[model samples]
Target: MKATVERATLMKSLGHVQSVVERRNTIPILSNVLIETSENGEIKLTATDLDLQIVESFAANNVETAGSITVPAHTLFDIVRKLPDGSEVQLNAADGRMAVNAGRARFSLQTLPRDDFPKIAEGDLPTSFEMPSSTLMEIIEKTRFAISSDETRYYLNGIFMHVSDDAEPTLKAAATDGHRLARYTLARPAGAEGMPDVIIPKKCVTEIHKLLGEAGDNMVRVDLSASKIRFTFAASVLTSKLIDGTFPDYNRVIPTGNDKLLTINPKAFFQGVDRVATIATERTRAVKMALEQDKITLSVTSPENGTAAEEVSGTYSNDEFEIGFNANYLKDILNEIESDTVELHLADASAPTLIREHDKSPSLYVLMPMRV
Candidate 1:
């Protein structure tokens, strides 16, 4: 393989593909990226961790020979990344070594046979749809914070996406860690009808979000089956295996009878919770919120740390009530809210609370209370 690619373009593409390669690998070829020159004289880079794969193609300045090679992903990325900006990078592969050349630096990495690189099986992605990149970004960003990290409940480790036609046709994305849940819905896009319910792994969700940030106003193409999902936008394509487990019936936990209304400024509430949480114990990170006539008192007491209390003005007309919540969990949900005011509907101190931007907004959050 022989090609000359602009340093900046190659580096940017490398950064995206190499992120899928893990730091440690049990299989030698898994640590390498496949580089190939296409018939039309474009350069393609591919990296995979068996479960997920990303392929990026870009136009290069020159292509002398058409061939393929596999080289260490991180090493190649680091070498290209260190090259001076606006420089031209020349790549040559022969004698089982791939050589990189720039202004005054040279790197030769041992290559693995291109045939040894494994590709994740993509068997007939029957369902395909297109949506604006910005819409996809919003759906991911609003709910990803609640993804579970516990390995025991493997099904909850990612965001659940499905089409809901209950009240209206919409695509809903939801995530929960058993302590808090976040759900966001948007009008279903065309061609998304009859799409299978799928759980997108957290890693794929993160990488797709990064890709969308650069996509601007472009549209993204999504193709998926019950077992795998693929995203294509710009010159990049990402394929990931879906989490093979059943997601719990999330609608059952979303309460519909919470009547006590508490309206507070989200920014003020976030700040108050953060301040009082400073003295909260590390184990629980619990903070008590006492709601009265027109004010809310945030308090925290730790055995090792001192106590803290702050009062924030709010609008509540119901009887006084107190509830305990994990400070970190509360702040995470609040960060996703973009409105000036947030409404919290409470059934009781022990029942799950419903939080939203307003009664009409499509986004909803449920946070379970903790004992302080």
Candidate 2:
């Protein structure tokens, strides 16, 4: 293929596609990116690792000849990233190598037959809908932090997306790692009825977030089948295979009927937790929270390290309660909450604590207490 494209545009597209391609692959072609030129003077870039695939198309200048080839993803991306941002990049294929020239620099990269690249079959996606990019971003940011990194419970390694009937048919995203659970709900989009529950893998969630993040004021088209899901945004399309196992029923884990409520300044609580956590044990990293009439004290005591206690004034009129939780988990929830105040409902030290934003938010966090 022979084409002239802007260096910045080419680098940006390569950065997205190469991230999906694995550094080491048993199949050589999987490590390369497929570049093809169309009759309409548009260039298509594609990369895949069998389970996930990304395809993007962009308009390029002057196509001398129509052809297709595969080049090493890392090498090509490195070459483009080092070149001047707005310089005109020219690429031509000769024999089994691809030549790239921009400004005064020239490089030749080995190419593979584009036919060897795997293509994810486009099936008839019966369930298709569109959602505002911002809505999807909110769900991802709120729940992705709680996704389990434990490979054994592969089902919990991704976010669970389903339709909920609580009040209305709201779209719910939940993630859990046995210790903490995060759930967020959004108003269901029009024509999103009959969508099945799907567990999108963690990698797919991250990739889709990057793809839709810059899509300002645009809606993303989502298509889901039995085993795969596809996201189409702007000029790119990403398809990923869904996790096979079933996600645990997260509703049972969320605690209800927690009576004691403590409202605290979100910023102060987060900073207190951050400071006291320094003295916590390396393994548990537990921070104790003691709640009294209108005062809350955060303390962390370690056998090796000294104890630390910080008092934060709060709005509480309930009975005295004390609880211990992982400092990291508490910080994660606070970071996701976009409100000035945070409400923590407690039943007892042993039971799960429910956390909510002071404002109206269709989301809640459940954190399992630890033995201090």
Candidate 3:
């Protein structure tokens, strides 16, 4: 294979696919990316780690001969990345090595046979829809932070996505890591009426987020099946396996009787939580909050680090009470609320609390209180 692609174009496409290639792999081929010249005169780059895969295609003006080859992903990415931006890149594959030439620099990378590269199964995608890329990005950014990190509770290790119909149809993304839960929703697109509920793994959500960040258009197409999901936009396609577990009924965890109300500035709340958490112990990251009369106080005490307290002005008209929460959880939830004011719907000190943005963008958060 011989082709001359602009350095910037080649590097950008490589950057898009390389994230799916893991640095450490049991199989040598898994560490490499598959590159081939398509029949339509486009360069196709593919990378996968069994569960998730990404394919990106772009055009090159000069073509010598069309061929396919596999080479180390990171190594190729770095080589192209360091090359002068406007320089022309010449790629040629002969014998068992792929040669890259640009300006005065040259690189020879060992190539593996492309036949050994595993292809992800498309299966049968019965549900498909397209939505604004910005809308889809908002749903993921607002909810994915709560995805569980613990492998034991594998079900909660991804975003739970589905379509819900009440008075109006809505598409929602939800995630929880036990201490807190986040749910974000948008108006359901026209063709997503019967989409199946699926748990999309954390890694896939992450890669999709990155792709959306760089997408140049307003829309992204999503195709869903029982076991897999595919996202397509521009010349890139990402396919991933659904997490093999059922997401819990998250609606039941949202408290309805949490009537006590407290309104606070989110920026202030996030700063207060962060400042107080400094004195908190590593084991507990705990912070105590007290509501009295007209002022809200945040306090942290650690056996080894003494104690710290700060007061932040807020509006609370409920009975005076105290609540304990993981300082990190409080900060994270507050950070996600991108509004001037946030409201906390509370039942009591021991019950789960609901945090809502004053604008109420159909996103909600539930934070389970901890004993300080």
User: What C-alpha lDDT does candidate 2 achieve relative to the native structure?
Assistant: 0.90
Q: For every model in order, what is the number of clashing pairs?
A: 0, 0, 0
- Candidate 1 wrong stretches, greater than 4 Å: none
- Output the lDDT of residue 154, model 3: 100
Q: Residue pairs in steric clash, candidate 3?
A: none
Q: Alpha carbon lDDT of residue 275, candidate 2?
A: 93
Error of 1 at 225 (Å): 0.7
Q: Give the Å error, residue 28, model 2.
A: 0.8
lDDT of 2 by residue, 169-218 (tens): 88889999999999998888776688888999999999988887677878
Which digits, one per residue and each the tens of the lDDT, describe model 1 over residues 1-372? 899999999999999988999999999999999999966889999999999999999998999998999999999999988889999999999999998999888888899999999999999998899999988998998999999999999999999999989787998999999989999988888888899999999999989988998899999999999999999998999999999999999999899999899999999999999999987777759999999999899999888888999999999999988999999999998998899999999988899999999978888999999887
User: Which number leads on TM-score?
Assistant: 1
Q: For candidate 3, write residues 59-161 as lDDT tens digits.
A: 9877768889899999999999999879999999999999999999999999999999999988899999998888888889889889999999999999999
Assess candidate 1 and give its TM-score to the true structure: 0.99
* TM-score to true structure, per model: 0.99, 0.98, 0.97
Provide the lowest-lDDT 10-residue window in model 3.
Answer: 355-364
Q: How are the candidates ranked when ordered by lDDT, highest leading?
A: 1, 3, 2
Please tell me which predicted candidate would have the highest lDDT against the true structure. 1
